[model samples]
Target: MTRWLGASEVAARTKSVMKTTLRSGTGRIHFLLRAWRPISSHTSPVDSSDIISAVSPKTLQKGGDNGNFKQDFMKLKQPRSSVTTVLQSGNSEAQRTSITKLRRVVKKLCKSKRFERALEVLMLMETQNKIRMSPADHALRLELTIKVHGLLKAEEHFNQLPNIASQKASSLLLLHGYVKEQNTEKAEAFMAKLKGLGLVVDPHLYNEMMKLYVATSQNEKVPLVIKDMKQNQILRNVLSYNLWMNACSELYGVGSVELVYEEMLSDKNVQVGWSTLSTLAKVYTQAGLVHKAFAALREAEKKLSSGNRLGYFFLITLYATLNDKEGVLRVWTASKAVSDRPTCANYMCILLCLVKLGDINEAEKIFKEWELDCRNYDIRVSNVLLGAYVRNGLLDQAESLHMHTLERGGTPNYKTWEILMEGCVRSQNLDRGINFLNNDFAGLKCHD
Candidate 1:
């Protein structure tokens, strides 16, 4: 007969025994087994009769009157087996749902810029071996790893992937990672390896290679990428042509840009966007082809709707570049008329153009008008006018405006002081300059 100890008595004795066993240099496993064993165990001092008395008749009958009490006690002691059985029954479905939820969470985390947590989720999924990662998933995980832990970790992850995941898309992602790290040699080598593998390299990959070259200021290598694209017979899109034009313009000059432009124009398959036209106009301006620049701008305008601020803004800037006063004013008027609400940027453009053209009186008048309606007072607008005044040797006007701005609780930036100091030196007014440095401009905070 086993005597069943009360719950409190059992707990206290178990704790004491565990402490004693641990201090005696016995292994913890022995204490744990002893502490957790049922009172019916042969080593326990409790009587079996106490346990038998506590058992209901139904339970005794279920175990059978022959009473294998130890077996019944063992069944009561281990509940984990039944719990594990229940857990294992629906495990596959639960695991599938968990994987699905984890993938969704990873995507959302990545979008929210929580890259570390996103990578942790991905690692958990990988360790669990419950989710089947597609090529895109592998690529995304590599990208996230690159962003969070850096390129070395991303490379390790990529290398650990199965051969099936080493497809063209995943390879492209790794190549992009190398490009981001500015490892030109590794990027080129990896790209070449991809080609050697007989992977059908797309135009985007070539574009990425070209972008890498451009970013590195290795402009000479850009045309080589285009040449490769041509040899591969990959059709050049507008983006490709633009990259070629930019590389050519930088290395060879406007003539090369023109040649590329002509080729792009003749290629009926490529649709010319406003960006293409803008690029052409800029290149023409750099080459001093004023009429050509105007023609490109006009064509850009034709493509845009009347209400398009971009077209109006571009027209004003190009005209200002050519010093076409009437054209700038005309385009500005047209923009203001069509725009429901003109932004500060639009007003700044017109003001900057007016100041650059040396129309000080008109700039002042426009500044006054803008001041009345402007919701935000940008110091940049004031700086433009101040710069014009200093350049034209109108130190008196600049000083007056500076003082007025200060009176109105406006803060002058570093450029403003520099301009005033320059004006003082230019005019040979050393005393006024010393005063400015000591008093007016003293303790001025410079913002970057």
Candidate 2:
């Protein structure tokens, strides 16, 4: 009898290990940093060009008489102790130039999504220079931490920030992290602490709190937060109003939604966008105001200019929720005509709608088309189709699709296996169930 760990259990264990690793490794400079030394008085000034040329592939390949590329490559890749020493030993102007070049390289790496290397460069700059980073720089590091590590590790890093680096920007980054994780309790506590410290609470922070409240199903707290924002003289933005209306639509009814919409229109700072109109349409549909909903959707479409794939996708989603299949197709077609090229996300939206409408054939067609053109494959799209097949009792199709995905070098995630296992169990296919279990065990062993 093999036992499989549930998703929650896996998540808990993963978080535990991450927290342990973060605590142990926090504030520890990379081993490579120890090798770096300030330049000596006897050494000549290290030119920026010298640094560049030293690491160049041509220089590495020419290191030996025999042109030993491997040895040269290894030397180039190894961190040079003299590199930092030379930078720090230079005159003020020379040092500034070196720092500037390093900063540019760091920025480029970050833009290219090479966050690990970016962080290493940042750490080297901070450790070697012994200069306090700007508040904005600290905030950037905080965001990068959240990106490279998970929220738990990010929060630990936030707590370790020096007092000077702990500004509103850093606080907001942590608050946003908590909101994203939907840790409402932690968000509220952090907010209270910030207020206790008499820190300036921006309108965006209040909006994030409202979002956290809404995400946690505590919609009643939203209006209270909005009122607090007003009392504090923080002008509400369009997103603030939309979140309020969404909460009201869920909690009160269409009447409350209309009142908020009216208030939003009156606010000088609030510029109602397509999201606002879409929110209204959703509320109207919920209240059984079918005609009003359609009108709102039309207004939303009118507001969107050409090449607005997201806006069109939103409209299609709203129509699909109302079971308007024709409306979904109409907007999707119109979107294709105007947009430069439909994104994977756009195709995903329409495929989901088709599946929801029980139009599996169309969904399959769209999925195949996306497969042909999508440069970056998304597993969620395949999972959606798999879900539809399983729900419709097309177990054979689901199994075939799963195998096909595996053959294409696509790794099936936990949800993929879960769905197949559930389908097998429900259909009383014992052999298939055993096969899925065996495959899952094999995957676990491979991971180990």
Evaluated at residue 363, the lDDT of candidate 2 is 89
**TM-score attained by model 2:** 0.70
Q: Highest lDDT, which number?
A: 2
Indicate the residue-level lDDT of 404 in model 1. Answer: 55
The 10-residue segment of model 1 with minimum total lDDT is 78-87
State TM-scores per candidate: 0.59, 0.70
Tens digits of per-residue lDDT for model 2 on 1-448? 2233343443343443334434545434454377444432223443454342334433222222223322232233222332354244435554554455455555765887867655555655555554446676677777877887677877786777777446666888889989988988889898988887766456788888988988899999999988888888888898899899999988899999999999988998768888899999988988889999999998897777685677889999999998888889888877876747787678878998999888999889888987888776666678889988888888778867865665454555667767877776767766756754653544533332
Model 1 spans > 4 angstroms off: 1-183, 196-200, 212-219, 250-256, 305-316, 329-350, 361-378, 400-412, 427-448
All candidates' lDDT scores?
A: 0.67, 0.71
Off by over 4 Å in 2: 1-86, 89-91, 108-117, 127-132, 145-166, 181-186, 196-201, 305-308, 337-345, 376-380, 386-390, 393-429, 432-441, 444-448
Indicate the residue-level lDDT of 385 in model 2.
Answer: 91
